[model samples]
Target: MAAQGLSGFYGSVFRRSITVQVLIRTRDHRVLLLRNGNAWELPGGVVKGGEDPRSAARRVARATLDPGSDVGRVLVLDYVQGSQRQGQAQGQGQGDSIAFLFDGGVLSTSVSAFTGAGGEREARFVPLMDWSGGTDEGHGRRWGAAVEALELGTVVELVNGEPASAGPVPAPLPRRMMPPLEGFSGILGH
Candidate 1:
């Protein structure tokens, strides 16, 4: 009876969706990441309405790197949840979001293009080994919970069951700069 009820519940309101994060690795072995205030994270955006997750991932990859580029197949489905933040007032009553993680290898052109940008604000890659050495309490708790739920093995997992990665790594980049898509809001609006 419980299984049947769950099936019905899911059937009535559950909507399938996807989000993608591209982990671009540079020629120097640095992993491309974004810093928003204080959190370090992969570059990605929510999958748009009516769009496939793979297509959305590809689109995000291009937007973060270049207008014309291709993103490869998924490396991992990190997490799926109703809300990333619960204590925050803004996170109240949101629906769901799924974060997809991918392995990105540098395209020769992208490397030169990023390098040419020439500014501290411009995109650059960080060595994964080095990234693993940093710590940020809040960022770790937030991103860590989602990562744990997704079951993806990330540096965040190194900590002793912490909700997010704790290290000196920079903050995650702002979401406003990310592409507009269905689940970008972090909270699902019914």
Candidate 2:
């Protein structure tokens, strides 16, 4: 079947979502990542209806990190397509998502402070060179792209980690990594 234009596609109506992620880093090269269910990932989730993406980033940071933590500019925009019915003949359509990976400025938190809750389990700062393994993005998968975004000073668009689109972002985002900070602990108290 031929693809319908934007108007026709809108008429059909399919579910799409906007998600926000924080590529949190410490003074060290480690990345502040999370594990939900089985995969290791950055701290972030779906953006609420009518809620600003930046605010959502801060909210996610507050919930996952210290309330005083800062949420920086977006580093990457990812368009991830949800799994479609494998055997669909054609034109059945599939779900997709638009994700914004924000630069979660260094939030000096401790590893022991990470506690599992609300479907999020084991949140910690993992060194970029390590990949203990758990979920797809647990290792350097998401972190690597985030690093590239910060270094290149551009918004990297990826469809499941492949080039697909392009968008403008801050000229140059900082590349702070994981390291032990002396003050300002995380909000997830032990």
Query: TM-score winner among the candidates?
Result: 2
Per residue, candidate 2 scores C-alpha lDDT tens digits across 1-190 of 3455775567445467788888777776667777666666778888998898899999998888667876888887776655532344444455566778899887454563366566446877787567343345422344566788788876667666555545543467775565545674544532
TM-score of each: 0.52, 0.66
Candidate 1 has a TM-score of: 0.52
Largest lDDT belongs to which candidate? 2
lDDT of each: 0.54, 0.69
The TM-score that candidate 2 achieves is: 0.66
Give candidate 2's error at residue 42 in angstroms. 1.0
Error of 1 at 149 (Å): 16
Candidate 2, residue 144: how far the Cα is off, in Å: 2.2
lDDT for residue 159 in candidate 2, whole number 0-100: 67
- Candidate 1: misplaced stretches above 4 Å? 1-17, 83-91, 108-122, 133-190
